[model samples]
Target chain A: MTETAGTYGTEFFVRWLEAVAEAVEREADRLTELDAAIGDADHGANLRRGFTAVRKALEEEPPTAPGAVLVAAGKQLISTVGGASGPLYGTLLRRAGKALGDDPQVTRERFAGALGEGVEAVSRLGGAAPGDKTMLDALGPGVEGLKVSFSAGRDRAGEGAAGTVPLRARKGRASYLGERSAGHEDPGAASSALLFAALAATARAEAADGTRTDGEGAA
Target chain B: MSAGRDDDGRGGGGMSAGRVGIVLVSHSAGVAAAVAELARGLAGGGDTAPVRPAGGTPGGGLGTSAELIAEAARAVDGGAGVALLVDLGSAVLTVKALLAEGGELPEGARLVDAPFVEGAVAAVVTASAGAGLDEVAAAASEAYTYRKE
Candidate 1:
C-alpha cells in the first residue's frame, strides 16, 4: 500500500525524533552559546542529555503508535532533562500525544491542531507569550504555519527564533537579566525551530521515498 | 550518606505516625542534604518529623531529578501529607511537573512556596510539632515574610 503525502504514521514520527536527536547533537554548542548570553549556559548540555535519553528509550521499546512515540519521548524528557526545557518541551509532546490519542495515522491538519495544543500547553506551563523571548516565540508561529504546510512551519519557526534576538526576556531565568537579556536569541526558541525543521525534513524525505511498503526496509 | 540511610530506616517505621513529612529539593546534592540536616537539627531531637533531601541529577550532577524527587517524597511521607521546599528554578518546575502529572507521589503532596533554607527550617519545625499539611505549608510560606533587620 502507498502512503500518500500529508499523512504521517509511527515510522514518520520515529524518523522525526531521530532527525531531532541528530540536529540537537549538531547544534548543542550553538544553543548553549546563545543561552550563555541571556541565561544559564547549560541549555545545550541539558537538551543533549535529554535527547540522548529519548533516543535510547526509542531504541529500547519502540512504540508502535505515533502518539505513544511522542508520549514516551515526553515522559523521558520530563524524567531526565533537569531544566525548564524538560517540563516545557515534555508538556508540549505529552499534550500533543494525548491529543493525538491512539490514531496510528494522522493527517497534517490533525497533527497541526495537536501541535497547537502542545504549544499552548508549553505557554501555560511557562506563563510566557509570543514576545516573551521563550520557546513560545518560535513554537506559536510554527504551529500556525504548520496549519498551512510543513515547510511553512519550518520557515516560520526559524524566523520566530531569529526574531527573539532583539527582544528582552520577560520570563524564565532570562527575565532576571532585565535589559541584558536583549540581543540574544532564546535557546529554547532556537531548539523549537529545530523541531519544525526536523518535521519538514521528515515529510520531505517521505515524499522523496515514494510508495514504499512498511516491510520493505524492516530491519 | 549516613544520614540518608538513617532517615530511610526511620522512615520505614510507622512509629512516628500522624506527622507531616518534609522534603528539601535543591540543585546540589550537598546543598540538599546539608539543608535537610540543618532543618532536622533545628526541628530538635526526639520524635521530629521525617525529613529527606532529593537533590541533584540521577547521575549526581548539579540538577534536579524528578525520579529522585518522587522517591524522596515517598520516603518522607507519613500518614499526614508531605510538604516540599525547593531551592530554585528547575527544582520548582520539577516538583510542579510531578504534582501536575499525579500518581508519582502520595496524595496531598504539596510544593510550599517559600525561601529554600528558611522555608525548609520552618516546615520541618512545624511538621515536627504534628502540624497538618496546610499548617506546615503555611509556616513555610510565612517564612517569606521574615525580617532580617
Candidate 2:
C-alpha cells in the first residue's frame, strides 16, 4: 500500500512482514477489543510486542533467505509473545520456513505449497478446524486463494475473517464461552487476514515498481 | 539459543545422579518460579532433583518464550532425560515449537500436558527419587486425573 516493491528473493517476505506489522499496529486496539468479548483482551498487546521484537530481530541479524527470516521471526514470537497465539503463530511461521528450505528464490507455486504447510502447522498445533472461528478460517481461505492469485487470496482471506463473526468459537479461550462466542469476530482470524492482505499489497507494489522500471527503460 | 547446559559437578546442584529433571513453564516468570519453589518443597525440599522454571518473555513480560524454555530444558537435563509441565495453551505450543525445530533432546525428554502446579510437583517428586523419564512424564500426566472433589 505504501508503494514498497516486492521481489523474487527473501525481500518479498521482508516487505510482507513489514506490511503485516503496519496492518497489525493499525488494528491492534480493535483486535484487543474483540478479544475482550471472548478472550483475555491481550491479543493486540501480545502481537504488537511480538512483531516489534520480530522487526528488531530482523534488523539486527538480517537473514538472506526467506525461510531464514521466517524462522527468525517465528522464534522471536515464541519467546517474546505470551499466550497460545505465540506458539500457534510461531509454529506456523517456523513450519512454513522449514518447508521453504534454504532456497533464496521462490516460485508462486512453491510459496503456495509452503504457506499451506504453515497453515497446516497452525491447525495441528491448535487442533482447530474450519468453522471453529479461529485464525485457520482466514488462513485456510488465504492459502487457497494464493494458489489462484495473490490479490484474490488476500480478498478471500478478509472475507473469511469477517465470516467468523457469526460463528461460535470452538478452540482457545473463546471455546470456554460456548454459544456466547457467536456474533463476535475472532481476533486471531482478523490478524490472520491482515497477514494475507499484506502479502497482496506487497505483490501489487512489486508489480507497480516493475512497470515503472520498464517505462524508464523505454524512455 | 545455546545448548548443552553446563553439567555442574554437584550432581546438578545436589540432585542425585541419573535422575529425571523437571521443567516448569508458564506465561508469568514469577508464577513459574514460585510454583517451582513450592513444588520443590513437596518434591524433596531444597537440593532435590534439578528443577528449572521457564517463564515469561525475555523482556520480563507475562508471556511464554520458547527460547527461555529451550534454555531451561537444556539446563535441567540430567542423564535420565527431562519431563516438562506447561500451564496453558501457548506454553504447550511454545515447547512443541522448540522441539519441532528438530534439535536433539536430552535422551528421553518429553512435554507433559497436565495442570502446571500439580504435575510439576508430582513429576518433581518422582524424578528426585531416580524415576525414569517415562515414569516421570507419566506421573505428571497422571495428575490430570486429580480432582478437588
Candidate 3:
C-alpha cells in the first residue's frame, strides 16, 4: 500500500477541481443556507462562480504540472470569488501550489504536506486558529487526518465541519453575530469539508485503479 | 512583485513627486469611489497623488476582488510606492492574498488598516505634499487615532 501512493498528476488535479465544483454546486444552497445564519449568505454563489472560473481557466490554458493547474485555479478564484473566501481559498491553493514546487507529480504524503501549508496560510491570513468556527476547524483536522490515513482524513473533515455548529464565531463577519453564530454550521468549514471529500473520493478512485504511484524516484 | 521595479519611473521626485499611490478597497464600489473623491477633495485637487478605487465585485456585487485591487495598485503606483486602505477584514485579506501570489505591490507598498474615509483623506493629502512612502503611510495610520466623539 505504501508503494502505491497516489500521484498528483494534472489529470488528478483537474478532476479534483471539477469534483469540488460539482460538490459545491450540489450543496450550494445548503452552504448559502448555513451562511445566512452567520454570514452574508453568498458563500454558495461565490464558490460556484469561483470554481466555474477555475474550470474555465484550466480549459483556456491547460497546464501539465499539478502546481500550474492549482495556481491557475487559485488565480481564477482570487479574481472572481469577490469576498473573504476568495482570498482565503485563493491563498490556500496558490500557497499550496507554490509549496508543491515545480513537480509535475507528487506523492500523497507530499501532497498532503503541501496542502497543510496551504491551510496554514489561511490561518496566517485570517488569524483564525482551530475551533474558531471558520474553515480552519475542518481544514486543520483534515490535514492531520491526511497525515494519518486518507480515509480517516476524510472522516475527520466531516466531523470537524459538524463540530463547528457549537463553536461561537471568533473571526470574520460571523463573529459580529456574537453568540447567535452558535448552532449554525460555518459555511467556510462546510465548504472546506466538501473540498476534502472531493479529494478523498478522487484518491479512492486512484487507489482502486492501482494508479497511485508513490513517486519512487522522480522527487 | 514588480511594484518595486516600477517605483522609480512614474512620478520622479519633487515637492509633488509622484503622489504616493493610494488604492481604496471596500465591499461597496460606490463607497470606494465616493471615498476617493472625498479624499481628492480633501487633497485640494491640485497636483494630488493618484487615488484608485477597487470596490465590489466586477459585477457590482458587494465584495472585493484581489485582481481589481492589484490592478488599481499597479495603475496608481508611480515611482514612490502604493498604500492600500481597506474597509473591512476581507479587503485586507484579499490584498494579503494578492501579495502572496507574488506578483503585485511596489517595493515599499503597504496595507494600511485605518478608518476608510479618514485614512484615505489623510494618506492622499500627505502624498500630495511630496511626502515619501513612509510619510504618507504614517499619515494614513494617523487617521486611526482620529476620534470623533
Candidate 4:
C-alpha cells in the first residue's frame, strides 16, 4: 500500500508498536543464539522480559500521545533491562519521542526525523559508527534508506532491514568477537530493521486507506 | 499517578499533580524487577506513579508481544500519557513492531531513548511528582542527551 505522509492514525501507530513487539518476540531466540556466539545468551531473554513488562504496564494505563507512549516504553526498557542494549534502545525511543514533541498527530517527516533521532541515540550510546557491525550497522543504513525512499515517495523499510546482512559487529557485546562477528548478521541490527520495516508498511497502508488526516500529505 | 508534595509549595499545590506513566521493556525479568524496585524506592514517601514491565513470560516463550503493548497503551489515567523504555535494539524494534501489528495505539505513548538506569529514575521521579507524560518524556529525553555527563 502507498502510505502518504501524516496518514497514520491511532490504530496505525498501535499496530506499529505491536509489530515491533512481535518481531522481537519472534527473533528473541535468534538474538540469544547470536549472543551465545559472542556475549551472553540472554539477549533474547532479556529483550523478551523487557517487552513483556512494557505490555503489562501499558495495559494497566494507556497513553494519549504517540510520543508519550514511546517515551514511557523507552524508560521501561532502561529500568527493566540491563546491559548495553537497555540504555541504547531506551535512548533511541526517548530521543525519538522528544523530537516528536507534543503533536497529537505525527507527520511522515516528523516520524522520519524522530526515528533518525533514535538511530543517532543508538550510535551515540554504543559509540559505534556505520559499518561497526553493531545495531548501528542495521539502523544506520536502515534509517538512511528510509529517508531516501520516503523522500522519493517509496517505502523501503523492509529493504533497509534486509541490507543489514554482511555487516560486522564493532560495538556492544558482539564486538568482542571481532571479525567473527562479521559474516553473521548482527541480531540487534536485524531486529532494528524489522522495526522500521513494520513502521513503513503500516504507515503506507494507513495513508493509502485515508485513515490519516491532518498530516497525511506532510511526509 | 500520585503526586508528591513539595515542601516549598513552589509547584503550586502541596501535592504534585500531573499525568505520566512509565513503561519498562527488558530481556530479563530480574532486571526489570530491579529497575521497578529502584523506581519505587526513589519515589520515597511520595505518591508513586505506575511502573509497568513488559517482558519474559513466567513459563517461557514470548507471551504477549503486540497485544501486550496494546494492553499497556490502555492503562494510564491522567492526560499526560505514557513513556516506553526498552533494553536492546531488538527490544526497541519488537515494541515498535507490536505497535504496528496492533494498529492505532492510544494517545500519548511516546518512545523515549535514554540510559535505562538514569531514564528510569528520572521518569519515576517526575511521574510520581505529578509531571504529565509529556513532561516526563521530556525529562527522560534530557536524561539520554546528557547520559555521558
lDDT of 4: 0.62
Better structure of 1 and 4 per lDDT: 1
Q: Pick the candidate with the highest DockQ.
A: 3
lDDT (10s digit) by residue, model 4, range B11-100: 443233235667777655567668878877877834687677765543443322433444454444243566887776545655554443
lDDT of 2 at B4: 41
Candidate achieving the largest lDDT: 1
lDDT of 1 by residue, A52-72 (tens): 999999989988778888998
Interface RMSD of each: 1.2, 1.6, 1.0, 9.5
Residues A39-153 of candidate 3 have per-residue lDDT tens digits of 9999999999999999888888887778877878888888889888988998899888888878877877888898899998899999999988999999989888988777877
Please list the residue runs of candidate 3 whose C-alpha ends up more than 4 Å from where it truly belongs after superposition. Answer: A1-5, A210-219, B1-17
| Angstrom error at residue B138, model 2 | 1.2
Each candidate's lDDT (Cα)? 0.86, 0.81, 0.84, 0.62
Error of 3 at A178 (Å): 0.5
Candidate 3, B1-149: lDDT as tens digits: 56454644453554434667899999999999999999999889867888899998878889998777877887777767789999986788888887666655666568876788899999989888878888888888888886889
The C-alpha stretches of model 4 lying farther than 4 A from their native spots are: A1-5, A148-166, A204-219, B1-149
Please report the TM-score between candidate 4 and the true structure: 0.54
- The superposed Cα distance between candidate 1 and the true structure at residue A25, in angstroms, equals 0.5
DockQ for every model comes to 0.62, 0.71, 0.77, 0.04
